[model samples]
Target: MVGTAADADELLRHVDERLPDVVVTDIRMPPDFTDEGLRAALQIRASHPTTGIMVLSQHVQRRYAVELIADNPSGVGYLLKQRIADVSTFCADLVRVADGGTVLDPEVVALMITRADRDHASGRRLTPRQQQVLALMAEGRSNAAIAERLSITEKAVVQHVSHIYDHLTLPPSTDDHRRVLAVLHHLSR
Candidate 1:
């Protein structure tokens, strides 16, 4: 449902009485649209550990996405509102959340990566190739697409991305998609 953090709390309190299994909230709402919806999502995760949550936002709030799913990713998802214009896709997002799958918006992910590039420390430390890969990845291109964009082989794109991740000291499981998010998080700051 759509509501503020306080409203969500109240709804949860009431629903806790009924034992619901899923919750969805917009990442911005009411009072101030500065990640309050994100706060509510986190609170739901904290108070109802088994409950699944899907947070929708106008933009990708990487910080909120990290906090919401970093500890326990199962049954958690984050999507941008712009990515869903039809009910079928929206319903699918909720289903994914209920099934413990992540559904991050590609645009949001790209935005986060671009934001990361702005970080003086990380940006300056990366090699030109690594930086270029990072930028292309943020554009939501797959390895092949990135390779085409950079006039390299897909395998080469993967290798360069691997180097980029290694230089950033990112974990192996940090999917290129999320690596972009992490980069964006750093850039945002």
Candidate 2:
């Protein structure tokens, strides 16, 4: 909440003046109102790698979501405006993004899962439970968070994540973030 702007240009100027830990912007802004905000966000991400970005939009726009996280999924989020109804959760999501975690709206995760299910060309199918775990993973949930949400043990969540990696044919990585990125990349395909 360091600064606010009416349009993308002003937003960029404000960012230049004083970079904030996280930036929450709409997908559309003044002057054409057609992805100007997203463009500005991409510019900011390019210039300020440490700054987190969250795009709150009314529309689904899967392509836009994919583009935002294409190069770097860390510290990025794409959430629907409807998510603001839960103020605490929304605020938590902002904090997570600021701390270099990727967060996608539940609706976005649902759409991605639906699309992935529809296009079953990957040859490896995930179990229903695996799908649920993957959805939470895409939402940037840690193992403990996923376990709590699923009413399971953290070790069980870890097992599901490992199975997901095996099913998706992702190479084993010591970095948890890389595992999330690999899963996200698979879903986006």
Candidate 3:
């Protein structure tokens, strides 16, 4: 694998040249250490839609998650540095992103879900159970996982998800990440 500690400019250059299938970068990088990597990630995604990006940060930044996920949820991930402690899961998540799957840090998902449930008008329309389902969905949980967590049947999870889509006015989509984007859209508004 090609590796470098370069700034966004160099990173972009490499991406342009290599067109690697996956990129794992820290949110903060050289020359400013602010959001250079995040900016580069956005540019890389815009320029190379097929590329996968995983942004790792020391802390949870809601805005970072919002911007990266707002436009598209596929082939992207936002994880905290602590996640690497579970190397197997972290590596699996990276592969999942490279394979066109969305992987969100649980903390980031909680932040968005809480904001949506507590403040968003659309969230106000949802029942408490529906809100719970939405939170799991935002975490990139499948219907089966949500069901196991909530101690409900998968069929019930499906029904709750349907209600969430109806309340959010999101048309049904086959894409797995659609629910995540929908949740973020509600939070953003």
Q: Best candidate per lDDT, number? A: 2
Query: Which tens-of-lDDT digit does each residue in 43-105 have in candidate 1?
Result: 778878877887787765677766765666667767778766778977877776676655556
Cα lDDT of all candidates, in order? Answer: 0.66, 0.86, 0.85
Q: What is the lDDT of candidate 1?
A: 0.66
**Lowest summed lDDT window (length 10), candidate 3:** 172-181
lDDT of 3 at 16: 92
In model 1, residue pairs whose N, Cα or C atoms come closer than 3 Å (at least 3 residues apart or on different chains), thus clashing, are 75-100, 112-184, 115-187, 116-183, 116-184, 116-187
Ranking by lDDT: 2, 3, 1
The true-versus-predicted C-alpha distance at residue 22 of model 2, in Å, is 0.8
Q: What lDDT is reached at residue 126 by model 2?
A: 80
lDDT of 2 at 80: 95
Comparing candidate 1 with candidate 2, which one achieves the higher TM-score? Answer: 2
